[model samples]
Target: MNALILVADDEADMEPLFRQQFRRDIKAGRFDLVFTTSARQALRIIGDAGQHDILLLLSDINMPEMSGLDLLARAKAARPNLPIIMVTAYGDADTRRRALAGGADGLLPKPIDFPALRVEINRCLAQWGAGP
Candidate 1:
């Protein structure tokens, strides 16, 4: 099965970066990455359940319309079983604490480590029993 991953980040280059990083997995049909430039857009995807069967979400902490933390909370409330990982440049204690408190499945530091992300993704997939 191809797992859909929703990515919410304001960074313009993130889409290309993720595409390049997960090229193999994408081509293999292991994952389908969907990028949204804002939390609002992410919310739309989360809200419209009929459209996207999201298996995981990777969102940046800071955004223009709504913060990723807020997005995390909302997404979790809507889909408690959904695994959401918060990504941020600030990997400080407070940030991590807030993310955990908001029910984030994991946190990834900025300048994301693709190898580590791959492991994390696999872990989430396995936990949800949706691994390829």
Candidate 2:
């Protein structure tokens, strides 16, 4: 089965960028990416059992209503084993520390380095004994 990645970001353009970047993997049935504009929606998806076979979560820190850090904490609480990576343009030292403290698996700054992200994704998936 394909490994699913749930992404929470307010930026509408991110959807296309992710889909384009992972087109090859998507076509190969290795990975699937799902995008949501808010933490609420992401939390809903996470809370709903068997809604999606999510292997990882990629979230933007500076989202509306709730921050990614908040989501990371809640998501971790809900699914302690799920890997979460925080993606933000404001990746300050404090933010990194807090993310790690809150149980985030990784963090990426914008504009994201897709190559590095791919490496991290593979590492996370391998650690979880899931997809490539």
Candidate 3:
């Protein structure tokens, strides 16, 4: 099945970068990525899209409106089973601890290593007994 990953960040450049990085997987129908620039938008999408289709959620800890940590709380409240990973450039022990406490499935620091992201995605899918 195709995994639909929703990534919420304020970075406008991320879409093209992610597309380029995951082109092979996207073409193979192994994964599909949806991007939202704000946590609020992401939350709305998550509410509307349902957790079954959205295999994973990747969100930046910093954003204009709602923070990723807040999104984590909202998403987890809506769907506790959903896996949501928090990403940020300001990743530190305190931030990591807060994210974990807020129910984030994983915490990834930026500049995101695409290869590591791939591994983490696969591991997350395996954990949920899904694929790609």
Candidate 4:
């Protein structure tokens, strides 16, 4: 089964990095990626991607248009059971607290641990009853 993942981050470098990191999964059609730069775009994708087999929503806490924490709340309101994860360059306690409070399933600090992210994605998929 294909697992679609929606990612929201302002960094222009993330697309290449993610495409490189999950090259196999993406090429084999096991994972499909949709990249966006802002929270607004991410929310629109969330609303539209619901019909697909969306596995997770990954967003950066710090963004230009809107914060990922706010996106988390809006996404949750759109899809209560959606498993959303927050990533940020800042690993501060307050940011984490806000993310959790806003209904994020996981909080990851940047530079992202790719290995750990893979594990977390699978774990999130399993929790949502979707095999990784």
Candidate 5:
């Protein structure tokens, strides 16, 4: 099955960038991405989808309604096996620690290095034995 990725970020600009960066994978049918501007919207998507096909979540740390950490916590509660990668412009040891404690599987600091991000994603998939 193709991996489903849920991307939550309040920034309107990020949507296009994410789509552009992951376009190849998306076209290859390696991943199905669901993008939302808010954590609440993401949660709604998860809830409405019944059985979530989501294998991973890529979320921004700072958001209006709910933070990515909160989202990670909720997603973990809903699906403990689901892996979440936290993305942020603010990268620090404390933030990383918090994310890890909150159940994040990985972290990507912005401005994101796309090549490194791709490597990390592949590594994550390999670790989960879900890679092609």
Candidate 6:
């Protein structure tokens, strides 16, 4: 099965940028992209589509109703093996600790560096023995 990646962020604008940045990888059959603008929407998407192809989740730290940490906890509870990476504008030791303690597989600071994101995703996939 093709690797599936879920991007969850409240900012609608980031969706296109994520698609654009990952387009090459996507076209190369590296991943299938799924997107949601809120944690609740993400949860629904995950619940509905997660069992099939989803391999990873990328989420922003802050959102309207639910935070990324909450999303991570819920997602992990539902799918323990699904890798989750949290993105935040505020990257501090404390925040990183919380993310890690919350079960994030990785953390990224925003104004997201796509190269780094790709690298981290690759690393995570490799660690899980899920990467091509």
Q: What is the per-residue lDDT of model 6 for residues 13-63, given as tens digits with 9 covering 90 to 100?
A: 998998898888889887788888999988887787535567789999999
For residues 36-67, what per-residue lDDT tens digits would candidate 5 score against the true structure?
99999988867655556776788999999799
Tens-place lDDT per residue, model 2, 1-132, is 567889999999999999999899889877789899999999999998576778889999999899998999999999998989999998899999999999998899999999998998788778767657
Minimum summed lDDT over a 10-residue window in model 2 is located at 123-132
lDDT of 3 by residue, 32-88 (tens): 899999999998888985443787899999998799999999999987888988999
Error of 1 at 76 (Å): 0.6
After superposition, the stretches of candidate 1 with alpha carbons farther than 4 Å from their true spots are 128-132
Question: What would the C-alpha RMSD of candidate 4 be, to one decimal place?
Answer: 1.6
lDDT, residue 78, model 1: 86
Clashes of each: 0, 0, 0, 0, 0, 0
Q: Global lDDT for candidate 2?
A: 0.90
**What's the CA error at residue 125 for candidate 1, in Å?**
2.5
Ranking of candidates on lDDT, top first = 1, 2, 3, 6, 4, 5
- Alpha-carbon runs more than 4 Å astray in model 2: 128-131
What is the alpha-carbon lDDT for the whole of candidate 4?
Answer: 0.86
lDDT comparison, 1 vs 6, better candidate = 1
* Pairs with backbone N, CA or C atoms under 3 Å apart (clashes), candidate 5: none
lDDT of 5: 0.84
lDDT head-to-head 1 vs 5, winner: 1
Give the alpha-carbon lDDT of every model. 0.90, 0.90, 0.88, 0.86, 0.84, 0.86
What C-alpha lDDT, on a 0 to 100 scale, does residue 4 get in candidate 3? 81
What tens digits encode model 4's per-residue C-alpha lDDT throughout 94-115? 9888899889988999989999
